[model samples]
Target: MNPSAWPAPAAAVANTLLVNPTIASRASARFPLALLNLAAALDRNGASRIIDGNLDRGFIDTALDALAQTRFDALGISVMGGPQVAPAIALSRAVRERFPQLPIVWGGYFPTLYPDTALNADYVDYAIRGQGERTLPELIAALRGEGPPPAQIQGLSWKLDGAPVHNPDRDFSSDDAPPLLPYAKLGDPRRYLAPTFLGRRTAVHQAALGCRFRCTFCGVAAMFGGATALPAAQRLARELGYLKHGLGADSVQFFDHNFFDREADMIPLLEVMARLELPWWCYARADALLNLSPATWTLVRKSRLRMAYIGAESPNGAMLKEIRKGTRPDQTLEVAELCRRHGVIPELSFMVAPPHDTEAATEQTFEFIREIKRINPQSEIIVYIYTPLPEASRHRKDRGKRAAAPLLDLRGEPVVFPDTPEQWTQQRWVDYACHADAPWLSDDLRRRIRDFVTVLRCRYPTVQDLRSPRWAKRGLSAMAAWRYRLRRYDRPWELDLADRLVRLRRPQASGL
Candidate 1:
């Protein structure tokens, strides 16, 4: 491809359009933080616009109208692996059909995990893997015949003569003194502030990037390659102050892949939060929480931390080590008690069913969850099937190292993963991505897990469900108390029927 053959750079600054095709309901939808960050970077030298499909039911047509009206150099789509893939495909195909010449770039977790699969489609002109803050601007400039050719761009996958060509992966960026995300691009930013258990107008922010641990089953590990970076204290203070004062956000939900890092490094940020005194929720590790110094814990309490979501992936210590999840089961139990004492709810999520020892592992996890509930009745439990990423989907740095064992279905046949975006739209594949179901799960085992979950949730209706009435929750709890006490979690037909009437919200689905 010759640079000279491409169109000349426009006299005015280039404008790029970003679309977030997440298929979540409006009530559950939070801010599209990924697009906002990209838009902020693009605004430095060029302008960018955001179209959030989660809030806009007619986003496809809206995006088409925008493209037809405005002169956009490129259309960047933020996609995730599961339900978002179908909408992304629809939007990409629609834009390509309507405007035949515009460049379509796909980014976010979907492209980062499967770059070749993303580039395999005729609609996707480029797939920006890893961080797109820097890659996107460079690619946009290159498309305008003003920068290096496509082959030179790092962390990019492009088709060369109808063949996918992936360049070397780019190192993670140092998030030192990063600019504030352009929330204004989303049109009244207040609309993104949702009502969660934290507060009435809860805003989501990511003060840090990536996770240091390389948990094999985690998409974050595959996307970030075990690298993590925290924001400067001043940057966090500025952002939080703006969100509170400028935007009227009463609470915050930190979407950091891992919020709590080293104790010494976290003090300044904790101090900032303590001063703000905003009720907050964050994703934390059991080990990290247990290791926090007494002084830091004081700061955490002063900050009014309402809840901490910890991934206690499994009760089996050996399984934890196998997945490279650095935390131990003991730490999980300890954190439950610790959170109880600190007046913070410990929302612990566990991966119940594993490919190997499927039944035993799941049953053990169920027992472990019961023990946690006994230790701290306020502890919240979330269960997910243990679904490991395909070897090919892993980060290049960790792909061949400590490769996963071959996975087998219940029929003893090797489990195969989808190769293209369209295939991922299948119901089974979507369920797999969401960790709701797995290929190795038998019909009996699936029903058992569902029945157990029904009983467990009914016994202790989650505090996060603001929609469900108080009388309904208490009635469900009284009805489920006997089953939960007797451990009769099999075939919970009565609880299931009652749940349908109450329509309780699953916190796992919304991540609130």
Candidate 2:
């Protein structure tokens, strides 16, 4: 239907109900920035409300109740492709059953990576790929009979005659000066803030959108297609000031895909952070931190940069290059030492157990992690199995070009990816998405990885574990020292017993 032929806004202002399906525990939950941004855009021409499942355990019922009380034009569910897929499916099914007429749209990494699969389910009506700030409002307008038909909406995938129809991908929006996120929509925003290693009452913000790097294995690359935009300095100051002075957030966590971009582009933002000095944590690339000038380093220090999560994916330079990670192993080591000198904890993550040379690669990475710890004992280590994205899951621009070598299972069978959201919710696929396990990892290798991780973490207890008593950490460190030094990472049943009693937090699973 032509937009001109549709009813006027006076007849109905499109109202949307946005939901972020449960992805984290209540204590680990941060502000739902994606939904907030979408809400801001929706409010520009219509009305929208947010439901973060992380904080609300009974979110499915709450969403239904909200829909019952209000005339919501559509329901937008934000889904990621791991454990979140299950809750998202449940919520989508519940909403579909109750509000049969209301349109249900799925967005975020899950749909962006597998739009067809997302739309395969009977519950999900439309899948919004890429940035939804623009596509969402436009989709809602079209659904409300106020705009063009579904085929004309870019970044939208919908079913036509029971078949998924994917429109041309949308260009990355210039979010240099986005509208202030409607945090007020989430009543009592203080509930979103939580204590972290950075400071008490740490709030989360995203100063940049997307990431420039196109690492073959990274979900960010598939979502953004190597596009990124940093916020304006004024916008950063305004938002940070409000987060600090207005909401009493003692610290901030910048959830930018890659926080430290080019040095020249980062100086202004760093200056604003320095002025605020609100202790911050962020995701950074090893090359970016290593290339920063001394002056820029001073600003970073003055800004109270507490921790930087660097993806040191592998110890082998060949594997790093094969994955197009952009940074090398030496750079990872250098950044560890550099972060140590700058008083920033380098939370380094390594992806071990590749499809080929699974055991040898895993052993190499363990040794490399030891070298990093020797350089800086304060360096926090995160280990994950190397699970590359399926060729079909790559962004359209990247698909079929430099495709990943075919994956093989232990029996030399081809590794097949799930073709539906329900399949993705299966334990094996969920493990693949989370980078926790893979099809090719043998039982012995998996146990070895677990044992090594247990010993390594016990030896160097992460400072991020605020719940575990310091005395327990010290005692665990003392107990694990011999195993760590001797490289005897066999099943440490005693350490396992003690760890069960202590219940140390896994920072990789629940970020600060």
Candidate 3:
């Protein structure tokens, strides 16, 4: 038979609806750009009629009623980190109950890492591992009887005869060149808020794929085949332009794990961002921030790089080494000071209650928090219990598994760390409150600490001010004054006392 006589390809048969379950945050939520990008990818490949839903926005009943009304061909739910797993499961179960005939497919890092576990669920009919930009459309086509069978679809998992089967991973490096996100499917871009920049009209985008550095606790590098690559700077620029003009977005947060794996690539991308003049923030390693040059700083200023969230993990040098964080405490300090000098707010994220934490190490972390506050009073510090990601080999111990289980939903709960006393764990939690200062605490000190805060709040009155960051600091300083006056406390001593007073109620209030 002649090739020219072959049959024409079939069009996309089923309309799709993608769901991004709530990350359990009420104050703010990010746009489901990953699912949107998947929709756009499907659209480019002749698959249209895509819609989106957030569990946080509408009742599950309403969402199901809408899906019932539309009769979508398939349901795509995105589950990235462990924190999103429980919500995704709930959404999947609800969708299955409402639309039993409709195919339910799970995607994103969680499913990618645990395909078998995802497929084993009673509600999940399929799972798309790694990247879904290509696999999803093919799966939809297959479901519609247009494309290959499930066995032939790469990067997909399905159960057969009560056993889960995973096909080969997709080579999706090219998929990093993101298509225009179908924000229209989401409706009312204004409703999507980014609170980091004071609730600006914001969207999330990715400039690079994968990370060059392989931190032992992370699985990104392994997931992407240890390849760190960048999309064309001009291409990224065009996508951002479309997001701005087409979707009314004024700010973007790069979802890249490490936006600057290569300095050369980053410089060109920063140059393009400078031309666009959109304020942005990204996650980067401490080393990357410390190495920024004067020219790069100028470009950063022009780009309005308002913040950098550095993955400092821990302030103790040994803990940093244990996690293979590839940077020292001094480098973290340097990066924090550097970002401050360049007028970019440095938000450092640390992990407490790691697998090997010692009481002494926890003490170093408490002191480290103070050093960061002193270096930049306006700096934002985020703390997490070291979560052993599902696929990582380093966190294979019994304790690691226990620690990882509770954090699967990204909720702030007390976690177990090996060889540490409960008092130390309690102390770490109190210090992580981000108050001006708190000393090491125990159960007996609770009442005294509360009384101290009550008295200080009465005198300082300004402690409740929220007009601006400066005002908050002024209020905090006034509260610190009490510790200085009565106890003859110096700066560090006053900060320690303030920390104790402000955070005393947390440990008892937030149960272990």
Candidate 4:
């Protein structure tokens, strides 16, 4: 058993269990840093009997077993803001049935956004609205009968006299950022697998929190607001070194909503990162790429920014504006060109069959994708049907009377947009592109895009399967058969050219 935080739990009042509910996808299960952060906070407040129930490691029974054996004052569940809610609800029910007296607390993006729904549920006893780092420790103190009254705790939701009571909101900018998660307390980080970088041991760490842009379909802004900030550059560099040298990670994946939002923070971080000699990848907006200076671009390349996952929602300027992407079609193309020039792979993604999707919009999307294919056949293109997020739905005025799931995974969770044609529901666009060979584009372009996704899913099944070992194995088997049948397109010469295109190198720095 893992030892307590310092001075062990004095009694049941100071014990806590941090549960990471099973997400349906393997891709979603990285290091549970969010839960670990809360654990560290709870530890500082004298809760040492902390049990980590990470379901991603195995079955629900394992987590339940941990809960059964450990003596916990409060049970906390961290859930994503989408389909994972279903699993979290089920886990809460099971826990309630077994330990009826223990208080059940829910924290995370889903609970933060939908506190009312989470609190009203039969199982959840408390909901932490914004950041749980501070709120969680305060709640633990109250549970120990040592801190302020429960009603005075900010950003908390719980029952009072059998009625739900919501405390006043906390100013996120003013709230103290929690210290680094107790990484050592959590078991070996290597067991936390990320299949994308097959050879290198990768760890997920956030450079910053919140987002600058408020796209119609994103919940980051809703949860954390537009203003984003990061720790001091030297501190960030130290953290990266710890992950690389301390945690045995060879690569780092930045979970920041947008890493390059502020030039002051990004450049210094990249400069320090260059010395660390670690390859990194992050999510960024196209506009951020366009706004970067050539020198800054050079510095980024020196820092080994291997790939950028950009949200190029649509190719049409009007649709881009409608979705509040704040990027023009030409600018996106320019961003791609710059990534190529700087020796970086810009993995561009697009949304299809959305509420605003029309025949003309479809044509624009195809045209945009076709152009990118011509420019960089090595680059990746991801297409998804527009799944409406709860907060985004409110901002979308033109979406005529469409019902959307509260939370969902864009890859699966079948949802039909309000404006999608009857024939195009359930991702029929992909079928038409792969099989029908729609009249608008040549068969070659459609074939290229289809093959891109097929090859990618095979190479990184975790993205497709999320984290289900069963599904990952099944996908690998299917990919083998697929390769055998499509031998014509898998020729050495063609594949060599594709690799050359995909792995573009940057111009060497003058001094280096």
Candidate 5:
């Protein structure tokens, strides 16, 4: 709030608990606020100086070493983006090495993703799966011999006599969860890769968890056991207090699986929040948004609901049915119209070539995006390749020489299918840009979609005057599609089309 009075540079004081692994922090732009805020909570409850290792090169071992020079009585850790498991284990080892007597605690998404992997990590003395504001401090108190034993703590995990012990966990869906720490007051995103687009400017709020729908390709469902909404009005007010007061951020983003999933819980909270002035963004399922009439959506809009990420996975009913998206084509379209009426940009996050996708079916999806933009050129849509993932699909187990991970090759063809996986991923992201209305682009692909667009502008008006950029966009996208055609059994005809299309298109640019 001042030219000279900025927040002070953070320094290390005693009793600090090193937080989050920096290795896998690049997933989003928002770094380790959870640890910083938790430190605040601990300080609010009675603890001193919390340092975020997530934004620092402070790995677990680094934190453990830092602990050696100072006298921090208790240790705490937060995790996410399952990749940090290795570094966390290494940190645990250091904690054991440097402070065998100090108590250690761990929590976050990875533990949420794989408690067994987390529980098994030898370095982790204990793990707390969900919402640790209350549980973590109690564990510290117990360690300090100041409060109830570990068993009484709501979300506790520990090792006794070399065996993992989990206290009967408490259900947190009803819990208000420590108010979202002030986003403005937290550590940097160069730490953890959750969501950085809004960077430190936007507040990330949760309206609900446990997506009621069962979509296998989704990381949210697999990462969290299921969806559960936060409690109604009063509880919602309390959490908002954290975003408004603790963080001093006015702009907000709800990180719910479906912001409108429960009208009973949502309407009251929104009505209350409407009294406060702020811009907000949210994600939603198409059917639920459609359930809100044009008038209700208008109210949501008047309340500063600026944009929404809607799941319109496919244009085909069969594709939608196959993924069990639980919405009809008509319903998705209705929501699209409603979004425009409310003046909220609907960024349709679409899926193509899902396990059930066919080339014909995908073309129809392109048409669907075209229709939305045709009605309103401002209609933004984004598409993603429905690449198979190992997270939660029934196809999770592959006994063969697969590396237990899906390493995305944005440039190469997909080897798994040998015939077309590469082309499919490329198209999906292109379609996503079209779907999100952000800008259809795929820099990772060997074929340049943006360049393809530049070439198309010769026949088409630039995107500003784009008379349905989708169709012309299709012509350019087909260049990569043709490449996939060649890979289909390495046939001669497919090869000729790939060569011919590139050859034919290469010179037209010179005339333009």
Candidate 6:
């Protein structure tokens, strides 16, 4: 139920049950969707179908095996692209190798940005380039019983007897429809999490979709063409009623690009969520809702709004401008202060070292995280390494200019992007370093990174998890930059980084 975008497709789906790759070597897989959304989309009109299996590593092979021999009608692959491209393309290849007639479809953040490249994969029968919330069902109908053979559908690219075909973009069909999933459904907690804990139940919810802000890192704006918020009560009633009456979900996690982008609508929504009594967390830019009122906080507390992840993106002022993060360090602190005052936990989504990050900037961000971590045990420090986001940045435009794309190994490879060969080796080192679990520190500049994290944990009692910072939250570029640099040394800089990173090796702490 992305507030801004249309709900999941209205067309009776072709029995397609979208599934995340089940723990494909840990990182290859994605977490589950809000059960409500999945249930809503699991419809029967064109054909009952699911949209997420392509991303699941465990069942992908099985799904493909079924696709090859089974009499299935439609196929969809959703990948965020970049490193995910290899698996996505490989899966499509697997599908083609197994079943030649099963009309395939591709969607997700990647295809939306590079429709042509997605078409390049011979295995892809059809590439869904935009919001498939509405388009997928329609495209399935156009294909299931045979209407258009991939040539006429909008927002798609497909093959016509081995040749690529492109189509004009179409507006989302479910633009005005209700959410595909009923919020009152409350989602099956087990289905969303491997463990029934306070953390795992906190799966993502797109009460609204798209973003009003044009932060360069987010794919929502580029993929969805910017902000679109569903009416507040219209959307709130679903989850509010559910949490209060249907299921007692204490915490809610938001997947929206910016929860506060539509403050006017949010205020009323908060009122409803508060009345319902739930806890929730969502991503936000610094003070995006600067005028957030106490009622907002009370409702937030009532609705289980305990945490908010804030993105500083860069500690360096200039980089923030270059990337258009739309917020600064001062504003970021403001956000933390506001959350603290309101008794909401705050996590810093920080960039350690990215394309524009410097050792100095990294130091500052580390200190910032430590400072916040000192204040709240619930405070989590997210560290990210930058990587090319096909749709998020100018990645697609830059891809062709890059020397070459690396080949993928399906048997199994680490589930991530390695911008360079050195990166591959470095990640290996860090992986091993984590196993070593030493308290050692380096005399070099990276020593500060080690020092900062060690101190931050002590300062913040609520910071229960003592491990490597969360990766995706840190900014992918940041992770890569520091990982590449830190791992470059012949010797392990410090055992703590690896020790800290042990958490990453755990089930994806990134999302549900």
User: What is the C-alpha lDDT profile of model 4 across 1-512, one tens digit per residue?
Assistant: 43222223447446777777665345335777777777777787566333344424453555567666666667788876443565677778887776676678998876666666677677888988778888888887787678896799998988876677889866566235454667765566666645444225767888677776766566665566555777677778778878877777777778787888767667888898788877777888888888888788888988888778888888777777766778888877888887887877777877655543334565467567657756764455666545445442232222332333333223444343222112222244323322322323334444544454445434333222223455544545354445534433333343334434333211110000
Off by over 4 Å in 3: 1-12, 24-27, 48-52, 81-83, 176-179, 193-199, 390-473, 480-512
User: Across residues 1-512, which tens digit of lDDT does each residue of candidate 6 receive?
Assistant: 22112122333335553434222333222234422343354353533334344243445666655443334456666655434455555566666665565566767765665565566666666777656655666676565554564566676777777666767766533244344344333224324422222343444456666665555555665565554665557566775455435544455566766676645677777776666555566777666645666666566666666667777666667677655666777776667667777777666766554432235666666666645544543555655543324332233323233321332223333334333212323443333222211112123434554444433332232232323454432432243344333433223334335434443332113332
Show where candidate 2 strays beyond 4 Å.
1-11
Clashing pairs in 1: none
Question: Against the hidden reference, what TM-scores do the models get?
Answer: 0.97, 0.97, 0.74, 0.74, 0.62, 0.70
lDDT of 5 by residue, 149-212 (tens): 8877876767778676767655545453554443434444222322222333466666566576
* Residue-level error in angstroms, candidate 2, position 340: 1.3
Sort order, TM-score high to low: 1, 2, 3, 4, 6, 5
CA lDDT, candidate 2, residue 297: 98
State the lDDT of candidate 3 residue by residue for 15-132, as single tens digits: 6777777654443455666777788877765544433434245635555765755545677888754345556666777777656666788887766656766777788889887778
lDDT of 3 at 58: 61
**Predicted structure 6: clash tally:** 69
Greater TM-score among 1 and 5 belongs to: 1
Clashes of each: 0, 0, 8, 5, 25, 69
Candidate 2 residue-wise lDDT at 480: 98
User: Over the stretch 249-318, how does candidate 2's per-residue lDDT look in tens digits?
Assistant: 9999999999999899999999999999899999999999999999999999999999999999999998
Number of clashes in model 5? 25
Question: What residue runs in model 4 are displaced by over 4 Å at the alpha carbon?
Answer: 1-13, 24-28, 48-69, 160-164, 174-179, 193-195, 391-512
- Judged by TM-score relative to the true structure, which candidate is superior, 2 or 6? 2
As for candidate 4, its clashing pairs are 25-466, 25-467, 26-466, 26-467, 27-466
